[model samples]
Target: MPWEGISGLVNLMGTWMTEDDPPVALHDEKAYVATPDRRLVFDSTSQKTLETIRPEGGQPVSTLKRGDRNNAAPPVVTDGSSPLLLAPFVVRQAGTGTQASRTVAELVAADAKTGKVSWRLRLDVADWTKEVTDSLAISDVGASANVAVVTLVKKGSETFSNPSTTYAVDLTTRRVLWTQETFKASVVAGGVVAGTKRKAASDEYSTPTGYDLTTGAERWHDAAEYFNTYLRPAGPDLFYLDARDRAGGKNRLRLVDVRTGQTRQDGVALASRCRYDGVGAVVCWGRDEVTGIDAQTGAPLWRLPDEKAGRVAPRVSSVWHGRVYGKTSNDCIRPRPGVTSWRTGIPSEIDLDQPWSLECRRQGKGRALAAAAGSASPGRR
Candidate 1:
């Protein structure tokens, strides 16, 4: 499902892209380097690494007591005067008994130059994860410049752990704004969280609810009792929820605006995965074909298998800036890697001679496409 091999940098000028040699060729994991001064640092797990960039009197910060352990999550880089570095650190007093350890945690703020804690706030770890871990820690973090959402997960199987408690923090004031009761969050964008809620106590909650990411207020709910339980975000305020009839007939999709709920409902069955090109089109790939729909009107834009199937339809790698870049599905023949316009469903004239890798900006922009790579390729969001 992922592209493996070398990475090549190409610049798109319209219908053509000129290839260029990149300055560095690190593997996906080691593709980034942080710089405080003129020197380059790898940001290893060390207190010294934080003192690269900073501000004058970095503000009075709170500290974990002499024996308290701060289980910190990864830091999220954002723009603002809050702090050069912000991370959710779960601080706990040492103990080894039932239900593990401490529920105390802190969302920390600091400057890169001094690594001094600009501020810290106690976090509320959900009761769901109490029995799962002997200690509390932030598993992952998602944030904008002003708001941050941290996921506290439950012990899961080999595949992955599910989120139990999600906390939204105000980055500016270093305050815990609100908490969402989401067992699993699908997507968070434009201050909206769309995910499955814990209606009662069981983990079998299928109804996906859209909540205000900033305030954790319930905005809308989608019934996903049977067929499917996924919602693809079309915009900050708009998302597409499956509203198909369980009885039979043609499946339908409801385009919902979190502000007022349902906007436009269409009788179109989108693929299992869909990408909303920030523009006005939503490109989707069903099992055997690719389709496009106008995000606003919910009208069908185009679909593959209409004559030039092999040349246009790709395996659906990724959609960015309104273009879908992917390798052709019919690889048995000559593999044609192309970029198709999600709005038109027509393949671009540009040909990616090196189809070895795909580019995804997960951590930061420094994460380039790994060329001539290995087992782990660059991640996609």
Candidate 2:
């Protein structure tokens, strides 16, 4: 598809898609464009220029890319009355050979409604010396409340190792809250979880630590015997998955309350993969059953079938409003069931399982319900 559209009436080149990058469309019917020389936003419908930002001599690169695995911290649009846009800019080093140049990563924030730049911060990788060239790349960017969390990974031609660091910035005042050296990090409900491991140390243990989001104070830390660990944030709690227990029998899932640093549920067996439904429940699937767990409290609210059976159970694909949408195997011919309310513990039958599609729509201004499609997934829910 063409990336630029030339509107002869306005003499402007509006952007739809760029080379190897995704379309940057905002809430107010505007699209963002970043060329090698300039960055601009234009109206999609009218093809009129709204704002333009031209860097002096650096290349203007778009942070919005489709299927970008390199950037762990991608651009994010925060939720509020006036949304904010956080983006990254990369300035290519001007040189040749291994020690000729270094790359710089810049983080910029702007008001989404108006294309005004709020604040710009330059992330320094290391001291640039004549001997060695140093470079840095943004790995991740996550936000919660009024704070923006960023992770920068070091990349260069030198043989020395450079550890990544995570920084928490206050969006209101544009001041940095705190920064810590860690390998990986994520923003949780009330804090940030950072994973740290030593380089080339045989006996070094990897520790996942939690820090306060507002003040960046150390709240809690969990040291693991093994290095392979995963942390997932769901609501007000953090789920720690320890793979060391897999050797014993089953994997362990630890649910820790982010506020008090207390382990609410420890050493729980994980049957299968689980994910938050964005409503108020964590939907998980096991061998032949699907279960819903309350987010606030780590209690299982409702289980399908209500009894153990060999029948293939439906797996939750998406949840919207108050209904859960899932699909079953083709061999199972039983009608699909729906849970009326997780709080009320009621069950009802909706329709039979389709081959591969699921959809949901509102009925006469009522709640949304799941409906089957022939070959596509749910449209809304």
Candidate 3:
């Protein structure tokens, strides 16, 4: 099939005849397509093959490698000059019984243009027992300044026991800068924001920690204990929601200064689910309301109250330019008072003016919001 007129297939594995496969668009008019054994870059306009990229050392490493179920799409980062691909390779040991397999996770960087391997770093595995099966998967990849942040989840056989680790790699020198261990982690502002959970007999809460992306040194740690919290990249700051009460009881929406580890403002109480709209605001939905907050300062910008009766609730799906696009639930709009719209469904958009209210709504039928033209959507990748 022709993918956006940017890529098409030539053949599939084990076939001499020409076939078609989906293509990955890189930049400009160039796209990458997979063959039986290698990946080829071709021009979309001219329909001419530009380059054939085979794995170095005959080891399979292409994101389009066939039959490799664990392969993930390599994240591409740029140093403001050229794109660099962060390729992940999984080496599984052959064993049985208590001798569980050992997985070697590697992070390799290659030049996007020449497809030449530049640097490789072996990611460390979490300490595991022989009886436990362990595996590692790349969860996130991001870059800021001269550092590239890669997050991996080291999972064992036990449920909910997996801990994610974040590694900061210096792109200029191609060296491992630092690493941090947390339940989850992401690149935020100029540093790394990591979260860890602690469970006690009386209380269970999570903490958000900040680290310097360059040196991998601990910058600041929050002393507050939250029932649950989610961290998101908000430009140079971190936007987070902390739930103190369960089941739509109460939530705090705040923006953290990644450098100072402080809230940009006294965060206001809002719903648990929220999305950053790339254009300097975040939209959150509750039982009967939708809200917009400034991404940088955490100040309330607008509020839309929905007094409609039923179990259906309004949800902000995506924000583009200055518009908040979302949908409304068809079930019970007001299933219960104080309930959130996190899981509710529907499609709608809200005007950003004061006393915000629904500007657009599609009842009964729903359509997913499209990405804003000429701008990237907010939140995290």
Report the number of the highest-TM-score candidate.
2
lDDT of 2 by residue, 79-197 (tens): 68877666555555466566555555566777766778777776544333222223445533457788877766555311123445677777888777777664445445555544443
Overall local distance difference test of candidate 3: 0.48
Ten consecutive residues with minimal summed lDDT in candidate 1? 32-41
Candidate 2 at 215: error in angstroms? 4.1
lDDT of each: 0.47, 0.48, 0.48
lDDT (Cα, tens digit) per residue for candidate 3, span 1-381: 122222222123211121111223244454544332244555657777665544332233223333333222223345456766445443345557887555545666666665566777676545531223234456335666767777665543211345555677777887777776554564456555444433421234556677766876777777776665555544336555454534444666666666677887555535554555545666665556666667667776655553453323444444444554443433212111222222222233322222111232223322223222211121122
* Per-prediction tally of clashes: 11, 5, 16
- Residues 55-155 of candidate 1 have per-residue lDDT tens digits of 12221123322233222222344444433444444444455566544555555555534445566667766766556554333533445547766665553
Q: Using Cα atoms with residue i matched to residue i, what is each candidate's TM-score against the true structure?
A: 0.59, 0.61, 0.60
lDDT of 2 at 221: 68
The alpha-carbon lDDT assigned to residue 318 of candidate 2 equals 41
| Clashes in predicted model 2 | 5
RMSD of each: 11.1, 9.8, 10.8
Report the alpha-carbon TM-score of model 1 versus the true structure: 0.59
Question: Which residue segments of model 2 deviate by more than 4 Å?
Answer: 1-75, 89-91, 95-100, 114-117, 126-141, 153-163, 191-205, 240-242, 245-250, 267-273, 286-289, 303-311, 331-381
- The RMSD (Cα, Å) of candidate 2 is 9.8
Q: Predictions ranked by TM-score, top down?
A: 2, 3, 1
